[model samples]
Target: MFGFLKRKIKEFITGTKKEIEKETKEEKGPGERAIERAEKEIREKTKKEEKEKVEEKPKEKSEKKEAIEEFEEKGKKEKLEEKEEKEAEEKRDGLFTRFKKIFVSKKLGEDDFNNFFDKLELILIENNVALEAIDALRENLRKELVGKEIKRKELEKEIENALKNAISSLLIDSFDLIEKIKTELKEKKPYVIVFFGINGSGKTTTIAKIAYMLKTHNITSVLAAADTFRAASIEQLEKHGKNLGIEVIKQKYGADPAAVAFDAIAHAKAKAIDTVLIDTAGRMHTKTDLLREMEKICRVAKPSLKIFVGEAITGNDAVEQAKAFNETVGIDAIILTKADVDEKGGATISVSHVTKKPILFLGVGQEYGDLKRFNKKEILEKIFD
Candidate 1:
C-alpha cells in the first residue's frame, strides 16, 4: 500500500548505512591507534637498550679495573632502566586516558548523524509524514544509533538493524478489535461504536464494511443513521442495511443526531443485537457547532468505542483531522481508507503515533472484502522487504 514511502525509506536507510560504513572505514578511531603506537614505542625502546649494552663491552682489563668498571656500568644500567620504566608508565597512562575518552564518546556524535538525518527529514517531509512523527523517529534513531562503538566492518549491518528496530517501535502496538468486541458483547449486550470523520473521508462506506465483517462472523449488528445533517447520509446507511439485510435505525433529515443514536442503541438493546454501529455526520473539524453535535451524540449514545475514519491518501490533512476529532470526542481507534491507492501512506503512521491509538483496519479497495486487519509485522515487512 505504501509503495512510494517504502521505497523512499529503504533508499534513505541504504544511503545512511553506506555513509556510516565509509566513514568508519576511512577514519580509524583514536583509541585503537593510540594503543598500537604505545606498543611499537615500547618495542623500539627495548631494542635500543639491548644495542647499547652490547656496544659498551670491552676486553683485556685488570681485575680491579674490570670490577670497578663493571660496578659503575651496573649502576648506570639500573638508573637507565628506572628512567625507561617511568617513561613507559607515563605512556601507558596517556594511552589509558585516550581509551577512556573514546569509551565515553561512544554515543552518536553530532558530526556522524547531522548530514544523514537532515536528508532523512527532507525525505519524510516530502512523503507527507507529519513533522511530529518525523521528529519522533529522528529522536528514536539517535537513541538507537548514537554513541555505540560499532566496528567498521559491522557498521552497515548495525545501522540497518537499528533502523528496523526504530521503525517497528514506531508502528507496533497491541490492538485486537475483534477480540475486544467479542468480550464486550458478553457483558454489554450490544456494543455500540460511533464513527466520525470529515466529509468525503469514506466514513459511510467504512461503516458498511465493518457491518459486513461482523455479519460474516455471525455477529448481529444494527446500523444507526445518525448523520442527519448530510443530505444522503441516511439513505446511504439504509442502502447498506438493505444490501446486508441488517436493520437500520434512522430519523428524518434535520433530526437530532444524538436522538437517532439513542434510538439505535435502545433498539439494539431490545433486539439483543451484538453491536450498534453509529454513523455520524461528516463535519469539518473547525466547525464548532458540528463538533458540539458530535459531543452530544457521544454523551447520549455512550458508545462502547469511538472510531475515527480517515483517508490515507489525504496525508498530513488526515492526520490533522484525526487529531482534531480525538481532541473533541476522544477516539478509541482508527480506520484508514483508500490505502491501496495511497502511494505515500504516511497518514497511517502519523495518525496512530500522534494520537496514541491503534489502527483497526485498512480499506484497501472498494469491495466489502477489501478491508484488511492492520498487522504491524506485515506492514513493516512490506515497507522494508
Candidate 2:
C-alpha cells in the first residue's frame, strides 16, 4: 500500500543522511578549530618567555650585592609568573566559553535541516498532499528533530523514527464501528447513520459494505435511498440492498430527500430495525443549494453518526471536499475509498489531519469483504518500511 509515497520518503531520508555525513567528515565546525588555534598560540608564547628569562642571568657579583640582587630578582620573577598564569587562564576560558555557546541552543541551525525540509516539502506537494497539511507536517518535524545533534551512523534511524511519530500523531484516532453501533442500539432501537460525499467517490459501495459488515455481526439495518436528485442513485442503492438481502426505503426522483429520510426512519422504527443507513445524493460541495439540501436532511434525520466518503486517489481534492462537507453538515467520521489504487495516498493522511476526524475504514477493493478497518500502526509501518 502507498508504494510510491513510501519509496519517495525512504529515498529522501537516506539521501539526506548521506549528505550530512559527508559534510561532517569534509569540514570541522568553526568552534572546534578556534579552540585549537588558541591553545597552539598560548603554548608557543609560554616557551619563548621561559627561554628569554634563562638568557638574562648575570655572570658574577660581590656576595652581599649578589644576595640582594638575587632576592629582588626572585620577587620580580614570582610577580611576572602570577600575571602570565592569570592571562593564560583567561584566554583558555574565553576560547572554550565561545565553544560552549554553540552547543547549548534549543533549536537546530538552518544548516542542520533547512535543505532537507525544503526538499521534503516539494516531494509532499508532488505527491498531492494539501498545502495546509504539508505545512503542519513541516512544523511538526522541526519540533521533533531540532535541538538535537545528529549522530553520523544513527542519523538515518533517528530521522525515520521522528517522521513515523509525526505522521502517526496526525493520523491516529481510535474508533470501533461495531462497538459504537452496539452502544447506540441500547438507547434507540434503530440507530440512523447518514453518509454523504461528492459524485463518483464510491459512496454507495461503501454503504453496501457497511451494511454487509453489520449483517455479519447479526445486526439488522435498513438502507434509505434518500438521494432523490439522481435517478440512478436510488436504483444503485436498491441493487445493493437486494444483494445483501436488506430492505431499502426510497421514493421517486424529484421528491424531497428529507422526506425520504424521515420515511426511512419511520419504517425502521415500525419494523424495530437495528440501524438505518441513509445514502445522500453525490452533490458537489461548491453548490450552495445542494449543500443546504444536505443540511435539511441532517436536520430532519438527526442521525447518530454522520460520515463523509472520500476517494484516496483524488488527493487534495478529496481533502477539500471532505472539509466542505464537514463545514456544511458536520461530519463525525470518514471512510476513504480506492485506497488500494492510491499510490500517493496523500488524501488519507491530509483529510484526517485537516478535519480533526477519525477514519473508520478503508475501501481496498471491489468485494464487500475488501473493506479494512483503519490501523495507524500498520499505515506508518507501510510508509516507513
Candidate 3:
C-alpha cells in the first residue's frame, strides 16, 4: 500500500505539472475550451483522490497503532535501562535552575549583611539619594546592625528589615485621621487643608487627588483656587471641580488667592463640607511677597493642616523646597508627589528625614484616585528590593 501510494503521488505530481503547463499554453492559444476541459479533469482527479483516501483510512490507523505500540515497548526498555542517580541528578538540576539566575560552578559563598549594605548604599546613591542622606543611612545601618551576623539564607529578609527600620526612622509619624477629625470637631466648623508648593511640583493636582481620596473615604471637600498666579491656574482648579463633582471657588488671574481661599472656607463652613482643599500658587519659597501671600491664605482659611507639596523626582531640591515652605508657613506635613516615579529611583527618604515633617500622602499618578496613604513598608520594598 505504501509503494502504491508513493507511485500514485509521483504520478499525480507529474500529471499536475503537465496540467499547469497545458493551462498556461492554452491561455496563449484557444483558451476557453481548454480551460473547461482542464477543470473537468481536475474535478475527476480530486474525486478519485477522495475515494483512494477513504479506502486507505483503516490501513493507516492500524499501521499507526502498530508503530505506537513498538515505540511504547522501546520507551519501557529505555526507562528500565536508565540509572536512578542520573535521572535524580537531572531533576535536581532542573529544580535548581527554577530558583537561580545562573548556575554557580561550585557551592556559593555566604552572603554577608555588610556586603548587601554596600550594594544597597550604591543603589541608593546611584538613584540620586544625597551624600548626606547616604552617610546618615550608613550610620543608622551600622548602629542597627552592630554585632548581628546576618547570613546568606536570611539575606533577602534581613535586608528587607534593615530598609524597613531605616525608612521608619527617617519618616516622621504623620497625623492620625480620627484624632485630627476630633480635634477639628472641637473647632467645630470647616476643616481646611491648605496646599503649598513651588511651581511645577503638582500642588494643584495633588490637592484634587487628596480631595478625591477624602471623598472615597466618605469625607466631602470643597476645592479652593488660591493659586492666583499662572494664567491657567483658575481653569485648572475649575476643571478638577467639574471632573470630581466638587464645588470650587476661584478668582481672576493675579487676584488675591488668599481671598479665594477665604471664600472656599466660608462656603465649606456654610454648607458643612467636612474638608476643604485649597490650591495655592506655585511660588518659590525664597520670594518674600509670594511667601507672604501663602501666609495670608493660611491665615484667612485657618487651615487645620498646611500640606507642603514636594516632587519626589526633584532629588535634594525637594528638601530645599520643603525647608523653605517650613520656614515660611510652618508646614504641618508634606505630600510627596510623583511617588510612583520616586519608587523607581529618587530622594524621598532624604527629603522626609531632613524636612522633619511627616509625609501625609504620596501622589502615585495623575488620576484623582492615584494618591496612596504613605506606607513605609511598601515604599521600602519598592525602593530597596
Query: What's each prediction's clash count?
Result: 5, 0, 0
Error of 3 at 117 (Å): 6.8
lDDT of 2 at 349: 82
Span of ten consecutive residues with least summed lDDT in model 3: 101-110
Residue pairs in clash, model 1 = 106-147, 107-146, 107-147, 108-146, 108-147
lDDT (CA) for every model shown? 0.82, 0.85, 0.68
Better of 2 and 3 by lDDT: 2
C-alpha TM-score for every candidate: 0.78, 0.80, 0.64
Cα lDDT tens digits, model 3, 1-385, are 1122223323433443344344434443544455446655655565565556545654555465677776785576455445543554565556444433221111212333355456556556656566667777776766665555433344335545665686568766666654576567677767878888888899888878877767777777899887888878888888988998999988788888888888888898789888888888777635797678877887788888888888888777887778878887888888888876663334567766776778878888899888777766665555444
lDDT of 3 at 89: 52
Tens digit of per-residue lDDT, candidate 2, span 125-174? 88888888888888888888877776665678988988888788789585
TM-score of 1: 0.78
Task: Summing lDDT over every window of 10 consecutive residues in candidate 1, give the lowest-scoring window.
Answer: 55-64
Ranking by lDDT: 2, 1, 3
Query: Which tens-of-lDDT digit does each residue in 1-385 have in candidate 1?
Result: 7899888977887787677656654454675677668767866776687557545643333344667787887677678767766776787668766654544322358667767789978877888889888888888889887677765446556766776676667774647777889988778788989999988798889999999999998899999999888888888889989999999998899999999999998998898899999998887746687679999999998888999999999999999988988988899999999999998878877778889888889999988788899988887777777
Please give the distance, in angstroms, between residue 285's alpha carbon in candidate 1 and its true position after superposition.
6.7
